[model samples]
Target: MHDHRRLGRELGLFGTDPLIGAGLPYWLPEGAAVRHALEEYIRDTERRAGYRHVYSPVLGKRELYEISGHWAHYSEDMFPPMDVGGEQVVLRPSLCPHHAVIYRSRSHSYRELPLRMAELGGMYRAELSGVLGGLGRVRAIHLNDAHIFCTLEQAADEARAALDMIRGAYAALGIRPARLRLSLPGPGGKYVADAQKWRRSTALLREVLDNSGVPYEAVEGEAAFYGPKIDVQVADAAGRESTLSTVQIDFHQPERFDLHYIGADGAKHRPVMVHRSVIGSVERAVAHLIEVHGGAFPAWLSPTQLVVLPVSEAQLPDAEAFSRRCARAGLRAEVSGERSLGARVRAARLVPYQAVIGPKEAAAGRVALRLRDGRRLDALPADEVVARVEALVSARRAELWEAEGGES
Candidate 1:
């Protein structure tokens, strides 16, 4: 198995310390670089999709979850509540409750029915030590969560659009879903006991899935306490399956928090909440990416997208200047010339792009370009090379050479 725990260390991606506890893992510079790129990509994507980003406290008052039903339905997986000056607060296990409160803070009109709110937020879970391993299952989770407050007639379309976003994201990130799961409440499950609400929500999700024509399994007991959901399932190298993306239709929160909007008839009406995640947990997504690509990430997602190496000590100045130029052009670039040319090139073999400058090429203001797949182009002008790479990275193209035109 291409276990991320081993590969993370081998690639200088992440680390853990006993003092920081087992469930928490810290990102090394390389890992953090990849994570930052992912975050920016998701944020840009969300912005383009009309999502309004916000920041909410990771800690919430105890009564908050009680109203959202997390205290009753999910407290077992939550950290123990802390008392601050005789008031109880808990680290949130999910962002929906906080988002629900944010929606209720202001009045809304029918025109703003689909008020989409997004957050790249942190949530905590009390996972058992035995079940925790690597980034796949950690106590501290960085979630790419969002909620869409739409009317009843708009719920299905929003869910479908959310699925489209998920598919777009998976294609861009080079992720393949093992399965599509329609997660519904199981018998005797600890779910909100609202039969009509459950039926309506489940039917809406089913309609979306059916209309999309994507094959999926309807699994009982895989749903959230508040509603049913569409889960995008992915498997690691070891064939262990986990959900990396999800979409849910929640009616319970809008009612619990007395959420409403002014309707066209000038009457107060409840809004249906659609919950979606492009990348469920950032950690698990990275862990899967590491295993899926075996650490040779796509160019845009790679920590060090380009590495410039000098063929000899004499070319160091030229190589360093060229690398700085690449960096200035927004490529994650660096210079590596301390070792022999062959050794340094070999070290950066998995890197997406390598520019090897020899004495003649350096003097000519050109580089011997090497794509990670072992393709080499000789004596390309350094500036032209940078332009190709910059275009490729900015476009998030999946293949080299193809990015010069179309994706492969």
Candidate 2:
């Protein structure tokens, strides 16, 4: 079994420090490149799916979570409040409350019922030391969280659409869903004491699950304090499953925040809050990606997409020029001229493409492109090579080289 922690260290992706505290792994240069790529891809995906992105503060007034029920029901797992300018403020444990305030910022007409807001925001959890390990469990979380505010009539369809988006994202990331879980509230927890609301919310999620045509387990006592959720679970190499994506129906937050919209009849009506995540957290998502690909990310997601190695010192100028050309085309390319050709090639094995500029090939303004997949195409124009790589990356294709007679 492949352990992400091992691969993460071996690949120089991420690491922790004693001074920085556990569970807060700092991304290395290579890791940051991969993360930036993931962030850009998801932001573009969400924008196309009609989500309006927003930025909210990581800390909120103590009363904010209190009003959202996180302070009352989830304080034990939250960081303690600290005084800021003589007023108590707390690091937010979740982004729902801030998004709630944004939704209530102004009056909205029923025609704009479903206002989809998204943010790749940060939150903190007061996790126990023993439970913290690598990126899977972290005190700080950067969530791909979004909230949809719509009328009751539109909530179900909005939820179904979120599920579809989550599934599509998983496919693009090469992640396989282990199963779907319908998490329900159980007895003696901090669940809000509203049986009727619980039933209504639970029923709505149940219907959404049934119509989704995906088999899911209805597991009790595993829900959020506010409502039921549909968790898309993925298993690691060791066969341990965790929630990576989710769609939830939250009636309590809207009611608590007193969010409303002007209906067609010109009367104010309550709006339902639907919370969803495409990828649960940046840390966990990176962990899973590390394990899934064993550090050999797809071309687009690879940290260093192309590494140019000159066959000898004589070809250094051509190698540098080729690297610059690749960079101009938006490919991440670096030229390695310090070592022998064989050493440079082996050092860049993890990169998606390796370009070799020999004396003959360099003189011809061409390169011998060697794919990480063990395929090599010789004497191709440097511009043609750059264009093909840029195209492959922009399209986010799984394959390194485009489909053709020689490259494939």
Candidate 3:
């Protein structure tokens, strides 16, 4: 296992202080960079999947959770209550209830039967202090959460779309598809509401998986109390499995919240809801990425993508010019003007790759790219260098990308 605390401190990512509340992470610049990259990727992906982003308050009336049934099933994981104007309020632990409210705020017709709402859901769950680790486990987490309100007939299609989004996300992060597993909710009391509904929902999910030719395991009693879900498990470098995403079918919430839409028959009918997350929690995904890549992220995902080292003071101008060219090409490049080539290279290894340019390269109008593993690709044009870097980052080719960094 990666020494998470050491990695966080060494990378200047984030750290916990005794004075600061436990389980809450204060992101430093580097950490925030990684987080922002993740957010941008997920937001773009959600948009491509037709999810409308929305924001919800951090706190809501206690009755919201009560109606959502979270008060009964997950109350232990919630924060302490607050008395507000003779009514109880609580921090929002999930975004489903808020989504329900948003759905009801606008009148709906069968024409808009599949409305998908997404949020980078910042939520609080009262976890034990000891369980919290750097960006892996935190008190407050931003979830790539979304809810799809679809006609009962559209549930399967909506679920297939959610799974596709999840796969796309993992691929963008350079995670192998084979290492991720999907789990269908098991039989019995694992799901809330009627047994008949559970059976029907499971059948629907199974059909979706089969029609899509997506293989999934049927795990018993592993779903949330409110609904039957398709749970995603990701395997790390050491083959340890972690829950990363979920696609759930909810039949109860629409009824509990008294939500409905006008149907073809001009009658109000309850719409089925699909709850999903590509990356379950921002904090968790960061932690997984750290281990998955062994703290060496790909170019696009790297906090500091490139460090330019000048061989001597005379080469500073060339180094600056090269770095500027890289920046123009959307590569994060930094100039190491004051440091020796060797020292700069050593320091750059702390990041991913170093673009070490010297007088020879300046005279040649080319640069030798240094990989983190002590190999050098010599005498490549500045534009070719930029293109290669961009391709590696954009593709999220972590294995080759990290090896490229290591070779330098």
Candidate 4:
């Protein structure tokens, strides 16, 4: 049950400035590095999965949300619209409506049955000040979001594909989903009053989950106002569950926006929209990782992967040169000779590996490698050390010491 806020401070990841605002965190360099790594990984994964990445505006005209029904249904969660150049505009609270507009911007045939548009976009929400915590609950969020527009016949397959992607991402992060939830609309019209559409969308999601061989629970009144969804609940290191990923079937927005595609029958047809987030919020995901790993991130994800420690002033040049070698080998490395060797080693615990350049090892063109867990490999050639770390990073190994032959 490590507190992410404390861990963030200890690791120099992120912090909030009251003068700026609450629930808004400023990412330090270390934090930004981790986020960059995550963004690149997700982008690569989405590209390989046939998703087209795009950037959309963070603010939209009032009429845009009106057309998408967000003005009526989710206005309370949105920031007040600002009068900009005589037109009312507000920060976007979600990316799906903008994506719908993107789909409607062009005419598509059945050949483009599944149009997957992905973006690591930012959104703003009006959350209560009392509820704001670290990255878990923030006014600003960066979502690993995407939307899929497809025909009714292709809806289930697309939904299944989204689920598969979610599972693969979780597996890579060493996270286990506690349960899958089918969130359906409840009574009293908290949702849209389209019973027929709701029933169809809910059934389609259930069918996809059942056929995919994934166990799930059905919970009413939890669906988004637009439609039902498959919500993934993941337990943190403390065993507290949080919803991190989702596959939502949106039937309302496409119809509200009059989005359409030409069918095989040569007629206009409404394409079903599936909204998804593989890791939910990038900020929150990093916080989760910090807490789960106790601020010692995996080698591939660590901001500072390697640190070169010079045992004495005479060894400073060797330490600096070794760091350069590591940098040339595509690893994040730096030399630290300002502090005592013991103090430097203690600070290097935040990193995945520390290479000690002492007089004996520097003379032999070698270094002593120290693992975060206090394991040591003495007198390894500098190139060999870089090669070993390069392999771990290339494989995206979750733990440096757990890589095969990594233990000394």
Candidate 5:
């Protein structure tokens, strides 16, 4: 097992500075590139899935959470509210309340059967110092969050759509689904005291899961305070299961926030709210990827997908120029001309593809390609190299080198 903390340092992905406090990781340039790639991928995927992205504030008035019931039920996990000009405000613990406000800002209609609002929102939670670790457990979190406002009749269908999105994302990332947990409220005061609502929400989720033909285990008292949820648990390389994605059905929040849409009969009706996240938290997702792939990221997600190495100082210009061309063509490339050829090649191995610009290849208007897995391609034209790599990136292939003609 590759320790993510050590790999993170060696790869220059991220670091923790004591001055910045624990569980707050500052993304280095390399890590930021990975984060950016993941963010773009999720955004594009959600857009194609009919989700409208939005930006919400990181802090909200205390009264907002009060209305949403977080103040009473989840205050211990929240930071102490700041007294801002005689009003209590706290960093948002979740994006649900803010999104509820967004849906209420304007009148919606039945024509908009499913109003899907999404955001890569930041959130804060006051974790115990002893429990805080790397990106997996952090006080500052970048959540891949979204909320769906729909009619009661559309709730099950919307939940099914959310499940499809989760499955598609996991498949793309090469993650195998380990289990499905239908988390329900337990016999405790921690949950909203609405037995009727809980029964209805849990039944709906069970129906959705049953209709989808996916077996799941129902666990009591593990649900969000407002509702029941379906959690997609994936096993990491070490076979430890973690919940990476969730689709929750909330009936309490809509009633609390007075959220409504005009029905076809011309009367206002409460819209059922569905809370979901395809990749739960960006930081945690990257950390999971690091451990799952053992720091050898998929070609499309790697920070430095290609590194150009010059055999000698004489080939420096060609190396730099080729790297720039790759960058211009939307590939992450860099020139390694600082040390001996052998040393540079070793460093370049940290990346997926290494292109050697030597006198022989430069004269031929081509470069020698060496994959991370020790396969070599002799004197391929620069354009061909770029085209091959671009195809891999476009397809989001997991491996850079394939035994069968390097297609991946």
Candidate 6:
């Protein structure tokens, strides 16, 4: 198992302190840097997928939950209510209810059939003490949360578009889903006794998956109480699979909220709601990234992408100049621990990549790039190195690993 606590300390990422109370994470500078990068990627993807970004307040009236059925079903996970004037208010547990409120704010036409709204929402849920696990599970969690409002006829296309965005995101992280599982509620599961509704919704999802040629397993008894869902699973280092992302179709919420849009026939019709999380919970995704990369992030997402090691004081100027160039390219670069040439190189390897440039490389306007695993690529021009690093980060290409024996 990966020693997450040790790694977190070593990287100066996050920590739990008694003063902060239980189940709350204190993100240090390095942790915040990683989080910001992740949020930027998520924002970019959502924009590309046609989602309009909105900021919702952290607290909502208790009546909002009561109207959404969340107060009855999920009251335990919610923070206890506080008195706001004479009425009760509580922190938002999820973004869907808030998004639904936004949808109810406007009148819409068929032209605006597929309305996608998203938020990088910081939400709170009261968790039992036993459930807190570093960044994996916390009471304070940030989500790349979004809800898509679509007409019944446009549901399948919207779902596929969301899936495509998710795939693009995983591609950037060098992660791929080993399995696709489609969950449909059965008689004993979370589904309400609306047999015809469940059948129609499940069939539509299956048809979309079949048409896309995406192989998936039908998981009975795994659907959310609100609707059926599709989950993407990733294999960890130990070969255990965990859900990395999910797409849920919520048919019941729109009806419950009385959400409607004007149709081509000039009739008001209830819209379908789709909840998608390309990276699931940001906290869980960060923990998974640390494990999958073994704390050595790739060129793009590494907290400190490269450290410059100077041979001696005379070479410090060139090294500082080189680090600045990297910073100019939007890469995280630094220089520190000036010591013996060999010692500095060793310390540099402790990070993901160490760029050693002294009088020689600097005089030649080149840099010697070294990997953490003792591999070396030498004497590349600075511009070339920057381009190569950007490409690797953009592609999220995985490094080759040694085979245990030959492939079976």
| Model 6: worst 10 consecutive residues (lDDT sum) | 399-408
The runs of at least 3 residues in candidate 1 whose Cα sits more than 4 Å from the true structure, single-residue gaps closed, are: 403-408
User: What Cα-based lDDT does every candidate model obtain?
Assistant: 0.93, 0.91, 0.80, 0.88, 0.88, 0.79
lDDT of 1 by residue, 1-408 (tens): 488989988999999999999989999999999999999999999999999999999999999999999999989999999999999999999999999999999999999878999999999999999999999999999999999999999999999999999999999999999999999989887899999999999999999999999999999999999999999999987898999999999999999999999999999999999999999899999999898888899999999999998888899999889989999999999999897888888899779999989988987999999999999886788999999889889988888766344655
C-alpha lDDT of residue 179 in model 5: 93
Candidate 6 regions exceeding 4 Å error are 1-5, 186-193, 234-242, 350-352, 372-375, 387-408
TM-score of each: 0.98, 0.97, 0.88, 0.94, 0.95, 0.88
Candidate 5 per-residue C-alpha lDDT over 1-408 given as tens digits, one digit per residue, 9 for 90 to 100: 466777877888999999999889999999999999999999999999999999999999999999999999999999999999999999999999999999999989999969999999999999998977677789999999999999898999999999998888887776667899999878774889898998999989999999999999998888988888999887655566778899999999999999999998999999999899999899878888887777778888889999999889898899888998898889999988887888888877668899998899888879999988888887789988988888788778766754446544
Ranking by lDDT: 1, 2, 5, 4, 3, 6
- Cα deviation at 256, candidate 2, in Å, is 0.3
Better of 3 and 4 by lDDT: 4
Sort the predicted structures by TM-score, highest score first: 1, 2, 5, 4, 6, 3
List candidate 5 segments past 4 Å from native.
235-240, 399-408
lDDT of 3 by residue, 268-296 (tens): 99999999999889887887777767667
Q: Model 2 TM-score?
A: 0.97
**Every model: Cα RMSD to truth:** 1.2, 1.5, 3.8, 2.1, 2.0, 4.5
TM-score of 5: 0.95
Tell me, by lDDT, which candidate is best.
1
Report clashes for each candidate as comma-separated counts.
0, 0, 13, 0, 0, 0
Model 5: how far residue 386 lies from native, Å: 1.4
Say which prediction, candidate 3 or candidate 6, comes out ahead on lDDT: 3
| Whole-structure CA lDDT of model 3 | 0.80
Cα-based lDDT at residue 96, candidate 5 = 96
Model 6 C-alpha lDDT per residue in residues 1-408, reported as the tens digit of each score: 465556766778888898987778788887777777788778887887788999999899999988777787678889999997999999999989899989999899879869999998888999999967677768988888889999888888888887888888887776668899998776654345566677777877787778778899998777866678888887655566767787877787788889999988999999999888888777767777776666676555678877888777877888888789878877788986466878877666647667778778978988888877787876789887766665555554455122225321
